[model samples]
Target: MLLERDNRLEQPDSFYAGLIAAHDGLSLEQSADLNFRLLLILANQIGRHDVLQAAIAAAREGVTA
Candidate 1:
């Protein structure tokens, strides 16, 4: 289970980096839509709504920190 968890978490940073890069070309509405879709994908893969929420909240906090 732990191995599965670790492997699941081990997806390439470049994947998200690519998403961020792609986001740069988007209009505000398009960017918001893309981010929502990406969050849904991530939440499904990670399998925990609270974990997803916490991660997102933490990331937001980090950005402002």
Candidate 2:
């Protein structure tokens, strides 16, 4: 269960380009806010507690200082 939609983003290449385009000229805070909003939307769409938990764990698997 990936931390993403089953359909993923259609035309991934274009979506990637669009994401970059959206961030262009944004301040760091703006970019972070955009990311936060997108994450919430995607997370809601994912809608499986176990999958979300696993994905969160996997994402943090190597984080440390």
Clash number by candidate, in order: 0, 0
lDDT of 1 at 20: 77
- The predictions' CA RMSDs to the true structure, in order, are 4.9, 3.0
Q: List TM-scores for all candidates, in order.
A: 0.50, 0.76
Across 9-38, the per-residue lDDT of candidate 1 in tens digits comes to: 345797778767988878999999998897
Clashing pairs in 1: none
Candidate 2 lDDT: 0.85
What is the RMSD of candidate 2? 3.0
Q: Tell me how far the alpha carbon of residue 53 in candidate 2 is from the true structure, in angstroms, after superposition.
A: 0.5
Once superposed on the true structure, which residue ranges of model 1 sit more than 4 Å away at CA?
1-13, 56-65
Error of 1 at 9 (Å): 7.6
- Per-residue lDDT of candidate 2, residues 1-65 (tens digit): 45554665669899899989989999999999999999899889888989988888977887874
